[model samples]
Target: MIVTPPSAEEVTGHAASMYDRDTQDDGFVFAHTQVMAINPEAHEAFESLVKAIVASIGIGVYEAATLGAARAIGSAHCLLAHGRKALRAGVLDDDGLRAFAHHDDSGFSESEQAVVRFAERLSADAASMTDADSQALRDVGFTDRQIVDITLAAAARNFFSRALLALDVPVDVVPGVSPKTAAALTARVR
Candidate 1:
């Protein structure tokens, strides 16, 4: 069973305010934020980190990397969340976004394919990454800054996956997913 994190009402001070803002923004509090709310400072730091990362890479690339890593790790919650973000950013449609798990067969552009592969590789075994991997990204016209952003995006997704998985959070915790999208992810995970 999942360990229930403190609810918005259970928190006080900054955490409580953040929770209120999250509810206001989305009409429901996110489970990820709820988990982070246990330590308000950490939750704030996480939000700040996400902001810096998103600024470094455009939302499209960041969300793409996130989808790739989340898919590789089989985190259905992230897959749906980032998949939606990618769709909204016009990076891909739902079908195209879902195809990221096997991007080689998905008809994505060469650079997009490279980013997907990088995220998959990073999720699978980051320590095994070598100069050739970085070189491949450069070969695809990614600047060093963009490459770093991709790496950070993939790494951050893995960090979140590990934490959420360890906590036994249910995949349904993802908010605003359509039934079709949720079914697709559930089918994929199974």
Candidate 2:
């Protein structure tokens, strides 16, 4: 990483809490967690927003949107992390995740495919987005609130993934991810 994060012993308040939470959940501190802990308040706020988005749109859609944004942004980190999250949430099987990472929407429902396309467009070129982009989601029966939540999820992933990339944070070896799945997730990263 371009900047060294605080040591576990050196953190306090939210940083310490984040470290502890990562240890409890994943058995170690993630590189992204440690890096983000450098600004604990921002990290906490971002995480809270993500949680709210997931609660609003549901994990399956959140993961689909996240994966699409990650793939469009060439963020191996988000792809692997959220791909594992999708698996744990029962949103996708291993092969389905691999196919999704490769830009195949065949495994997804119509609504999910719309979400993915929307997220990819938003992440790749938000300035070019038109109202029709959102109308597509509406046509798929997504409420305005759900569309907003999906937008937030994709935008949040772009922010977090860009930060990690800028800082040169190494991708964590997500637990329970198969080797092939990991390879697929990172296939587009250079």
Candidate 3:
């Protein structure tokens, strides 16, 4: 995937508008968004799919699942972006962010740990998963609908993260997280 990402000005239609909005909201467009800008329609459709999934399971869980999947898939870009989003959503503190990679022993609840495994396994091998895999989420109080939504969120993260990595997209610099912290997360993926 040695594709060149389009500049914001190079993008047309809905994607150009989306890039503008991302810039306005975050002060800069993310590399992943810039790459998707080449096909604004597909980018919009993907955003819609992720929006639906996030709305169903809530942002916190969605971000948590994204972190797990991103880590497993070795997408440094996502690990940083979603890790920041998780922090912004009040799901984790600075110290918690530092421990996110080792989520199982990071003092997360059983439910949270389950979400991480679900996301990682789904990213690694979805076909190998059985009903019991989803049942564990239910045992932790996730509804069938929530489980489905979680699966979709993880799948969606994998889709975007893998593409960005394959394209050799660099991670955008997010504030608050030091370069050292970001480098550590990126190193884990390598």
Candidate 4:
């Protein structure tokens, strides 16, 4: 476990923090304590970014992309963390979230499919991204500005969440998905 668990009060992702209670609040706790402890301002900034991202996409699409990216990378910590919260927040259905974990192609809408594809591209091979993928995003109606923001966010999650897991931080964010996907999602390894 954690060599030194950060202060509970400093932790933002607690079980009772309006996200997941029993499931993945530990990450929130770690995130809270780490960033808030260092600079409380970061807390507000992160919150704002989260809100902006959610607002950028309708809930379904955001959750689909987030869950899809998390699962595609098999990041157990991030997967369970975001998956639970996304589902509870009505970002996605349990089935779709779980399907993402299994790398299933079905369950996502055409637009969502495109979004997830973007996330995957950024996650799997950031530097080697092909021009076609960016074009595909444009063809799908994503503006160039939005594409940049999306890429930054996806990369941030991948790097940040992976760091958290590597550091032995407790995960608190549950996968935002339907209960059905929980089984399939949980079955996959990091």
- In model 2, the Cα lDDT at residue 185 comes to 83
Cα lDDT of candidate 4 equals: 0.61
Measured against the true structure, the TM-scores of the candidates, in listed sequence, are 0.85, 0.95, 0.89, 0.72
**Better candidate number, 2 or 4, judged by lDDT:** 2
Candidates, ranked, lDDT: 2, 3, 1, 4
Point out where model 1 deviates above 4 Å: 101-109, 173-176
Across residues 6-26, which tens digit of lDDT does each residue of candidate 2 receive? 999999999999999889988
Expressed as tens digits, the lDDT of each residue in 1-190 for candidate 4 is 4545345444454323422333263434334244234443544566567677766665666665666567656666667666776667765566766666767646667776787888877877778888887787788888776666566567666765566557665543343444456557767654
Cα-based lDDT at residue 1, candidate 3: 41
Q: Where does the lowest 10-residue lDDT sum fall in candidate 1?
A: 98-107
List the global CA lDDT of all models: 0.75, 0.90, 0.81, 0.61
Off by over 4 Å in 2: none
- Which parts of model 4 have CA positions greater than 4 angstroms off? 9-43, 89-91, 171-180
RMSD of 1: 2.5
Instruction: Give the per-residue lDDT of model 1 (tens digit) for 1-190.
Output: 2666787668998788878976887787777667767778876776677788778667766776787788788887688777766766777776665555444426356677788888989999899999999898899898888888799889888888878777876654455556675666656662
lDDT of 1 at 110: 68
How many residue pairs collide in each prediction? Answer: 0, 0, 0, 23
lDDT of 3 by residue, 40-115 (tens): 7777888899889888788878887888899889988888887778777888776777777654426355787799
TM-score of 1: 0.85
